[model samples]
Target: MNRHESMLRIAASSDISVLLLGESGSGKEVAARFVHAHSKRAGGPFIALNCGAIAKGLTESILEGHRKGAFTGAVDERLGVVRSADHGTLFLDEIGEMPFEIQCKLLRILQERAVMPLGSCDPQPVDFRLICATNRNLRAEVHAGRFREDLYFRLNVFPVKIPPLREREDFNTIAQEIWKEIADHNPLNASEIALLSKRKWPGNVRQLKNVLQRYSLLKPYDITLGNVLTDEFSEPATVADTCTLYQAKSRRIAETPEWNLICSELSKNSGNKSVTAQKLGISRGCLNYQIRKHSS
Candidate 1:
């Protein structure tokens, strides 16, 4: 993230078109907005389009504008994204999914710096910095004849690759930053933080948010490694546990902030680790490890 931030800082000052390559939820759109906000075109309108979301027949008209009589439903003249974002930045997400027919028009728009609306006799000049993002491998798509090679070359001018969440060295810090978005407080302790770091968040930040949100929505929210890893807290509410999750059985003793109490338990059981572990409702190994940890 440090290196990526540094690149964003340097890239922000220039008007070079950028291609953001990363998995879904890996912050491509976030980076696109960042670049637009810091660029010279910051004062102008910032337009965004998701090519994948648009229907096949409407993609070109929506992006390149159309005259009132261009199509059956065209009652009013509408400006394309390029013209709408003239003198500004245009972010096209999921560019790989754009139909091949519209790709040629988009390429022309980039090369000629002009757009001709459907059924229009004149091509209007436009000026906008382009930023594109995609989770798919455009190179492979090009090799497979699904993407336009020339268009890919044009958009890949200032390529920026965002790393996956697990590969980021600042994992914990980033997770906490994301956690703060939906969480009112940072309730994760050191051990729990370490556990989350070790989790396999396949959906990246998106998955992590769902997970933490699930815990946060508990009858009485409590953040702990055991609660996060187990189904103990997700059980249906009962009269005895109406106000909160069953603390007696659902609460993991590891979250206890009393190291001295463990020592007392150890002494109370006459130094028998097995008896102490049973009384504390924790494994013997866990008790022993905690004993050694707090003793040191």
Candidate 2:
């Protein structure tokens, strides 16, 4: 089953803290948002914080809020993300980077259902579900004493592993969905999809999005696979003596009356820009440009 479907099933039945594990750009945050949207707390605030992005010294202040004059620049009292997410969900992205001391504090809150804000004498009760994401292997961190075992167990009550795009069966479906959203200004044709699907996308979804954006801006009218790979599609130098065979293929594409017709055929197969671009053996931008050019 797809990640969304699997997550939907989990969200409908559980209130356990969830841990979303995946590589960067693998849409772990998107999965977290989907879980929140599908859960009972859909109407409540869904606050997201990047644990690794926050500064080391200010981490406590950021998560637990600080009263006015709590620190050097504390001008006004502010609600920490934990308290603000009361009756809602808090998504902590990159939780593996959080300091061990902070993890201990977080474990206390989870165990006591209360938080002690900075510069505050009292501990306030809190009620919110927690979702944490990380790209690192926490088990490895635990071995090195960088992560707390008890905290890990508490947060990992229900773990959801978001598979990378390379392993996903719904890649084409998701690609088409993202393409429609991005290609509203410029439509794609058949040749583009074939070419796009053939490439090894190292950056996954983010890389795909960027390529489409660039294609839309650079060659909105006449994008083609050849145009996208013109600079990088060189033949192996060792086979230079026998390169005439490959050159013959290029000549065939150049001379054939069916070349444009083939592109048209591929475009019809997958109207999405990324897919079409893949089919055309070019970047999405090249396909987008060609589409605009042909349409115009």
Candidate 3:
């Protein structure tokens, strides 16, 4: 977090195109928001779009507005995300997922400072800082020809890599923040939080948030090593009463609709948390919260 904070402070003062590189759940979007909030365009709108969520066919129309007659579904003229973020910041998440053709258009926009809407004759001038993020190895993508070389270099002007949760030494602090947000009646005890700090979370902060949510759902709504670690918890804590604690929290799992949906999705996905999170259009953190909420 310190590394990112320092980089964000340095990047926020400039209008340079910045790229955030990290794992999917490593908080790239959050870092982008930080940069924008502290930048010169802080008063302007911050428009964020997930490139991976948009299909190739609609990418251009989405980035640059379309006239009413541009396409089959076009009902009115609109300023797309780029123009909407004029004088502000435009954050493109999963930027590496953009198609080759769209990359050309994006490069053009960055270079020319203008965008031509679909079915429109005149190019509207635009001025906005661009912040792109991706979990992909973009340099490798350029080598493999999956991502454009020019576009990669353009967005890579100021790259900031966000470290994963396990690499950060402040897991306990992060866990406490999550606990405060999700805990119903009480916060996790210090010992329980200590135990949580000892292990690694592969999914990064998103997974930690999920795990912390589970801790909040323990039988009596208090956190414990067993509730967080379960059989999957690593580097077992020195606390010897975790077994009895686990048994106590196993009394009953809430049967809410959300809980049922979570179970159904997990079963359908064969319990693959990452896939399930993607299918649900949410982060693993959110999915974990959903699971712990009902399966307590």
Candidate 4:
């Protein structure tokens, strides 16, 4: 881990573009933020945009800004994302998902250090450090003709590969850390931590955090972590027990920060279920379950 940090620091010392390669939910964005926080542009803005989340047909206007009256819906001028990070860092998450058409424009901007906004013939100078992250293999994408080879070479200047959580050597420490962050008032014992370390954690750290969040929520109701893990809470409940559980869940959902986070993310994603689920680090099914349970 120290070695990884040193490598990131070395990359951060210069203005070289960084390409973070990792599995989803493996903390690639966190790593990107760390680089931005440590870089010379740390004092400047750190703009993050999920390439996959950008609405279709709005890529150019969103990334390069737009002049007023550039399009049918253009009523106001915009600064766009690339210009927004001038003198700072721009983190592009899920860069692999960026459309092939926009890739060329991005490469041109990087080469020229300027952006040509929509409906503008003049190119405006811009200065910013770029950090891109993705779970897909750019080489494979390039071979598949889905990604541009020139762009891949340009962005892979300082490649950093973050390993999945299950492969990490410090699972226990990570689990304990997440538990502290999410359920500090209800610390896990050594045995519990060991049990966590033994699991596959297919969803990586994000999944572990979700498990801890569920445990914390159910603890006050005398629910055991084991039951939570096994989804035993879904078993049939007696009439009295059902009423109690319903009341408890209603109050918890109302007060728990995660519920509000869900609503906020859902709104931000324009109510796109797949995007919202991915952003929240939960499965689509899990998101649907929460909606069914709380949307009433």
Candidate 5:
């Protein structure tokens, strides 16, 4: 089996928490669903939570059940995510954003195999696996004290890292797969497929899906490479307008000093502002200011 298939297999048999690390829009949630579908707990519910999407104050109440009188607006008993994922899997997207306190509670539940609901005396047993994903480097966060080391270790068992689309060896195969998916929804000719396959998808699979969706709506009778590479592919603007902007930016970069080259290199290195600043032997704010100046 390929790496992706192997990952699914490992996730299927293991009850240990799996950490999926990948770039944004790299189909992390899709992989998580594949794991849950193939696992022994396939019959159970698959609960997904976006840690970054939830407010800090509501996170605890969301993870643990709340009694009728637990808080101000608690008029009825509410089932927390942990209880909701009873015999299935809890897929936590952007797990790095989970608060340290909530992480402690999560660690406790994973260690004890039980969850103590809010305003509840007794802890209820739960049999479930966790599949957490994050775009951020949790190790660095642990060192920075933004994330708890104990919680990181607890949730990082059987880690699976999904490569970005740009690094995928099976780029042609993936492109073909995306083409088939697009064709299922719309009737795209060979020219359109050829055009799409050549363009760099910075937004990855999600972006590809959106492109196909848009093309289907605005079905052009005669699709060409130029048409597919229009400004709509980048943003909501005319092709000429986007090209003008691109040319202007190119000219500005060309006119800049060696610092622009340094910034470009730094951006290629995952766009970590601090790292860029360090490499340039300058303060982070100076690097930021220079980048802003160049961008303007």
Candidate 6:
């Protein structure tokens, strides 16, 4: 992680385009902001737009601006995202979701360092750092003919893949820092951090921070991390009414996936059933009950 941060710091020193690759909720935007904050354009505007959220048929106008009366909704002239980002940084999230037709327009802007707004024949010069992020594999998208190959190569100049939380070696340290930040410097005990570090944390740091936030709120009421986490993993609010509650839960456990998950947790905890139960966000008693029932 330190190495990755160093790489980002280096990338910030230049105007080269950057492409961040990571799973959803894995802090790609945070990384982008880090680069922007450290870059020479820190004083300039930082314009962010989610390509996936761009409304269809309005991509050009939204990205390159539009003159007054250019289209049905163009009641007034507007400086779009590209122009707004001039002399600063433009962060495009979910770049892989950008429509195919708009890709060529974006490539022209990158190649020419200017934008010609809709209904305008003259191109207005734009100078800004480009940082694009996406969870999708752009190479695969390009191969599938959904993404432009030329555009992918342009954005992939300094690609950096953000590692997921579960794969980070500093998970425990991260949890500690988040607790201190959210809980007014009152640190989580070592055991609490240990229990937290054992979970898969599928939602990555975002999910861990959320769990810590809840734990911080409940800490003043004399609650433990185990209690907070148990509540965190409680069953969904809605369930089928076709069977008894216990039967429904047991049925879930009897399924191959759920049973395999339990076994996997047990193995990961080195055969320590209690630790496995904590990692699975269930009481040790419940884990034992299910294990005994299913063992037969």
lDDT of 4 by residue, 84-173 (tens): 999999999999999898899889989999988988999989999999999999999999999999999999999998878878887778
Each model's lDDT = 0.79, 0.74, 0.80, 0.83, 0.75, 0.83
For model 3, give the 10-residue run with minimal summed lDDT: 248-257
Off by over 4 Å in 1: 219-225, 229-296
Better of 3 and 4 by lDDT: 4
TM-score of each: 0.73, 0.74, 0.77, 0.76, 0.73, 0.76
Clashes of each: 0, 37, 1, 0, 0, 0
Please state the error at residue 144 of candidate 2 in Å: 1.7
Which regions in candidate 3 have their CA more than 4 angstroms from the true location?
Answer: 184-187, 219-223, 231-296
Sorted on TM-score, best first, the list reads: 3, 4, 6, 2, 1, 5
Model 6 regions more than 4 Å off = 233-296
In candidate 3, residue 75 scores what lDDT? 91
Residue 248's C-alpha lDDT in candidate 5? Answer: 35
Candidate 2 lDDT over 111-219, as tens digits, reads 9988888889999898898999999999999999999999988987778888877777877776677778876653455577666676666577776677666554434
- Model 6, span 39-112: residue lDDT tens: 99999999999999998778888899999998888999999999999999999999999989888989999999
Pairs with steric clashes in candidate 6: none
Q: lDDT tens digits, residues 263-287, model 1?
A: 8998898999889878877666557
> Model 2 off-target regions past 4 Å?
1-4, 185-190, 225-296
User: Can you write out model 3's per-residue Cα lDDT over 71-92, one digit (the tens) per residue?
Assistant: 8989998889999999999999
Predict model 6's lDDT versus the native: 0.83
